[model samples]
Target: MTYCVGMLLDKGMAFMSDTRTNSGVDNISTFRKMFSWSVPGERFITMMTAGNLATTQALISQLEERTKAPSERKPSILEAPTMFQVANIIGTTLRDTIAARALTGPVAASPAPNFNASVIVGGQIAGMEPRLYLIYPEGNFIEASPETPFFQIGETKYGRPILVRGFESHMSFADITKLLMVSFDSTLKANLSVGLPLDLMLYRNDDFAPFHERRITADDPYFEKISDSWSEALRNAFHSLPDYELDA
Candidate 1:
């Protein structure tokens, strides 16, 4: 399992994903689940993935190949005129990759492996407003809007409450990053499957390039501070609530 979040902010976008994969308690590994591509001054694109590692890796490899050889592959995300079109291309590619993996034997005689994955993609193109999308395993997707301005996939329940209470459309990049850290920290504490070092990316609207990007390792001092501080704050808030009195 993994955990990934892509949030739309007035400033642009923020993405964070954990790097843990496991087949069993005894078998665990770390692998990045976030990727980005750009055409400087024209477009900037970022994606976060959750679900089958094989399917997500294959989908990303195919997209990378298309960018490298657009003339041969066709409909590359870099060449898509709009972010909407880019989402369509990614959705189609992801769906096709899963389907192709299932055709390994006689259709009626063999059962397909679970090649299911989902994506959260967001970015901007020249002349168009920044956009964010949640693409499902089925190849269908929905754009983020005022009513639903963020997307989370994989082990989502453990971290969702922090985002629901803290996110703001007008928040600065610094604040959003802090919010995501707390969210991931909550998940890490609750579930062993969502271990870190986390990958983070921030983009400013219309920049056509990432504003900042980094990895937060287990020993990062700033993250340690955030985790401790949040726990203290939660305890304080709990204590502050009025006590109930019962009739004697």
Candidate 2:
């Protein structure tokens, strides 16, 4: 269980993913679920994954290895001429990795999640418009359109309402980031599996390099402030709403 989001904005794109994984109440761990690749002025790619940790890691590891040594898995994500092609390559790799894991069965003491992994992929390539996609466990994916400017994976229900109500195409990068912080914070409060230390990435249009990227820990001052303020605001909003009166 994890929470990850990718937003496509007028200026660029942004992504956030939590670093929490747990097997049971006693066994909990943190692992990064975000990966990025870029080639200066050529292209930039960022991905956040959720679902079976083993399946997700196997997919990411295979993608990373392909960049170092390309095999029949098609060109590395960095080599893809367009963001669409990059998504295809990633989806294929993910499907293949899960299939292989299924064939091998449970490994010793560790178990994989029977091909249940999904990813949010986004970035831009030189000459192409920025794009965002939600890749499903079956390898099929859908892109963000004007009607849908963002995609969220894993533990999504708790935070989706905020995005649905506040998202806008012309919002500044800062504004969108703040919105996402609120969303993530809300999800974190309601879900135990999705813990803190979130990874954030921002890419400005055509930069081919990230505008900003960082990990937000529980102790981070800004996140702390945002969390506190959002909670208070939500409470106030709830209290301010008009109450219904019953007529006898």
Using all chains and alpha carbons, the TM-scores for the candidates as numbered come to: 0.95, 0.93
Please give, for residues 169-244, the per-residue lDDT of candidate 1 as tens digits. Answer: 8999999999999999999999999998999999999899998999999999999999999999999999999988
lDDT of 2 by residue, 1-248 (tens): 89999999889999999999987767889999999999899889999999889999889888888898865456888888888888899889888877887778766546544567999999999999999999988888999998888999999999999999988979988888899899999999999999999999989999999999999998999999999999899999999999889896
**Top-TM-score candidate index:** 1
Q: Hey, what RMSD does candidate 1 come out at? A: 1.8
Q: Give candidate 1's TM-score.
A: 0.95
Question: Which residue runs of candidate 2 sit more than 4 Å off their true CA positions?
Answer: 70-73, 106-113
Report residue 152 deviation for candidate 2 (angstroms).
0.6
Clashing residue pairs for model 1: none
Tell me how far the alpha carbon of residue 83 in candidate 2 is from the true structure, in angstroms, after superposition: 1.0
Error of 2 at 180 (Å): 0.7
Best by lDDT: 1
